[model samples]
Target: MAEHPAYPVGLRLAGRRVVVLGGGQVAQRRLPALIAAGADIHLVSPQATPSVEAMADAGEIAWTRRPYEDGDLADAWYALIATSDQGANTAASAEAERHRVWCVRSDDADAATAWTPATGHSEGVTVAVLTTDARGRDPRHTAAIRDAVVEGLRDGTLVAPHHRTRTPGVALVGGGPGDPDLITVRGRRLLAEADVVIADRLGPRDLLAELPPHVEVIDAAKIPYGRYMAQEAINNALIEHAKQGKSVVRLKGGDPFVFGRGMEEAQALAEEGIACTVVPGISSSISVPGAAGIPVTHRGVAHEFTVVSGHVAPDDERSLVDWPSLARLTGTLVILMGVDKIGRIAETLVAHGKPADTPVALVQEGTTAAQRRVDATLATVAETVREQDVKPPAVIVVGEVVNVGVQSSPKTSE
Candidate 1:
């Protein structure tokens, strides 16, 4: 294979309109970078995988629930053609070119205006790995090399220029899911070094008990569907505490970027020239379900899985969701923040042709001691959740594999 040429300068896609022409895992991986760059993303696909839909629901991206049309590129500043279909990718590339928009074809590297680099970030810095023509390497191999480089840097064996900063402050870490044991070692070390602790309500309380008694503690819990400090206020507090040279820990449950709004706070700190670092956490979306004996993917049972946020803004009119396609697909659907809208969501799925008796499970406080499971059919899950008073911080798993959980339980329990 011939090496693809590299661009002379990397463009910052901040606030630009970029259209992604797929909705699978590849697109999911790409979506975060575009979002982090503050790109206005319009995803053009007939159906969205769960992560894409969740991003759409969170007002992070726009969705076009139809096949890519030439017109879709009309307003796009750049396009990422990443569908599995090579022909579709070619068509998308042609259309993008016709509309004078820069396009990156995932299936054809040479056709793209720019290739995405495997990127890593530390406080106040981002490192992107791009292959030089001399390397003459496979993109996959390049990505693997990038991962190794990132891992080495993270492990402190490789000293990148940015890591030399001696700035004394705290990094708010996302502890991930409910498993105290799952907290990253780096996060654990940071927790031990903290001068003050401010944590979310959902994380394991026992984890905080380990902190030294003299360390100041503040409760900055934000309950779903309940009154709490606005995100702006939380950011302000973190910055204020850090400015005083206090090592403050703003601990959040789950991967901070997944739904914790860590990015927003990071960006705010960047504007103020405060050095900030993020230690990645395992996301609960996959881990929580696995803990409950539910596999998000299985051979033939599900080739794909979609994760969505059940929480929606009251005034948003865009239905970024394609319930009908989701209903028809043979895959698993996982929903977070779905307790309140369980009734509406169940109704939509059933109304769109999913069986009324489709298996559904509401796993509450997953991976924690308080974990609870409520099982019901699609038609009755809403009522079941209401009757049981199941609340947020719960995950809803829908599809055939749900039946596995139902069957595994003792019949007498049901």
Candidate 2:
């Protein structure tokens, strides 16, 4: 018998019992939504994906650490049967039927009483698409449609009433390394809604071009580059624009707080009683290395990592970083703006205590199409830098962690 067309309605599952019968990809994909819905998720599975295991370890959800029992879903308001085993899915569905709980089957959507929809969210709206005969057709079409709608919503091409509230204020946005797609959902929305965007040279410049024509673009690079003078001018700009009832977005390359001068701008705004919000970006200190296949913090190999600016040389009075202490630590050393000073920095580290042959990976223009990776050791980093003609706006990683992720690194995977 064919199932009746399912009625679409939002479930009030907040703080309610929800039982999940698998820990595979399906469960992993659905768990984030369930967790966000405030459901008390009970995951039953003998094995789990690494990410799910980490979540369980973090106490984000309850893990049974075994196969589902007869009464696992007895009091569950909702049950998701998503194991790879056909028999297990059938068994869990039967149990859910007996318990009068709605079951969502991942393996066979038709076998279960409930169906999951292709969902997309932007701003404050969530779009869910459900086809009556989804199994008979290609799911890619539905996904494509969902993505198109979400993109339209994101770019402000498709406007929904009451979907977003635009309050004029300053948003310190970190555009994330270099990828235009890497900007946070909130950051993108804020950018689309921005009346004035003050962007840095290193930020995702492509995104600024996508903004509406009415939006004013301020080049932060044009600002005077004095320790106090540069920042003071930018602050005044944010306050003045926002005071004019214009939504100002102070867009930076990486994380606004990690040498991006975001908090300082926020402080400046607060002093003038202007409303400001901080939207964090993926910092190049960690992300740039990852783009070059290097994890800043690898398990067991690197217990910690330090990110420091190389904008100033070691001999400069303005430099406050303790090079000797940094060289002594047994973790990753990620240096930004160090291309010009790479030779000097390497000399100082080697002179202090760091190994002359320590593994180094310099990722230039990370996460972008122009990205390039140059590998070397402390003793030969300067030579490699010169050989590759590596330039500024690159990440220089110094440690064993660089060896763990890259294929050529001497270290083995954990």
Candidate 3:
């Protein structure tokens, strides 16, 4: 047990030497945090785990590829002794003590000059917990407390109403394909902090139901064709709400930049001098195909893949996609917002020399309980959609790669 209470201090180790004496699981678990702190990490180990080796290969740390020697901690500001050899750890700890560098011993907590508290980050705050009772140190209890605090802060359950710094800005967050759980941690936390959330019809709709009652949810569902005018209104709404000092979040489906016109909103905010944050979401172009058990690019089957927005027909004057070139490539083609124009797209592809028998898969409402997959070839896709009543918001994958993992998951097609 520690003789006295541990004095917790945040060390700014950026550009300072931090020596790690091992590359085992303990070192692997702790090195990432040190690296994130911008420490000049020097790792000394005879051999390392694959993950640790990868870090070395990536040049995040300098590995000596040898056991810890007496003078390894010569110029280190901080040292962590996690070697399997107790003798080596003891010697390294003594060397750190000589150098006046704080040392943490994974093998012996009581012998450690410093303790690594269970730490977690939420928003901009870091929560660290170290529990040392009369019995001894309880790492599990400390970790549990850290988790509870971080979770509370993330979900806004432990809000400090008066102490909170509410900065009004526009956050363009990606809600991910459909599942509320698929949204990123930062995206969800921003949602919990938002005062007004302008949402789309296609995103993780269930997340809106989880928001606090005070949050105003504006439906920014841009219906086909005519809703272009509504986009101006939505942009104005974002600008107006932000100018009024309200935390506004423009929650989009998939990634905001992926055909979601996220730049337009950002430019509007920039012109008005409002702060904007872009939180990328999991795009359905790649995710939807995988959720339906289809790999976008499979070995030997496909070496490349293309994501195309098919909202405009192939022959439309406004169409920017080169359909002839796309059909000529022997790779995967994933089309978004193309369910309505599937027939014309299929016809165009077949006419441009693509084989009619090339396998095609359509994933609808992906990554959700309502998700389903519809299978068809270029020749039959148009007819299949008609017979099955396939609707919008479906991803159309075209290529031989669609057949590779098609049988891995069961498809619920109505």
Candidate 3's C-alpha runs over 4 A off are 1-7, 49-65, 74-76, 95-100, 134-138, 157-165, 222-225, 410-414
lDDT of each: 0.77, 0.87, 0.89
Per residue, candidate 1 scores C-alpha lDDT tens digits across 1-414 of 245457545667788889899898889888998898899899988888898899999999998888776677888888899888788888888888788888877787777666677777643456677777734646687778877776555433354533343465658688888778888867876676677777887665668877767778777764233443567777787888888877777788888888788898898878877778787887788888777777788776888889877785222365466777888877899888778888888888888899999888888888888787778889899789879988878988998877665555543113
| Candidate 2 C-alpha lDDT tens digits along 1-414 | 344566787788999999998899988899999988999989999999998998799887899989877889988999989887889888889988888999999888777888777899986789887766644645788788889899878866665534556677899999999899898878887888788999998999999888778899999889886868988989999999999988899999999999988888999999988899999999999888876778888778899999899999887888988999999999999999889998989999999999999999888998999888888999999998888899878899999987776764433211
Report model 3's TM-score to 2 decimal places.
0.90
Q: Sort all candidates by lDDT, best to worst.
A: 3, 2, 1
- Model 1 Cα shift for residue 402 (angstroms): 1.3
lDDT of candidate model 2 versus the reference: 0.87
- Top-scoring candidate (TM-score): 3
Q: Is candidate 2 or candidate 3 better by TM-score?
A: 3
- Cα lDDT tens digits, model 3, 132-175, are 56247778888999999898787666674536667889999998
Off by over 4 Å in 2: 1-4, 15-32, 39-113, 132-140, 151-165, 225-227, 294-303, 355-361, 373-390, 400-414
Per-prediction tally of clashes: 2, 0, 0
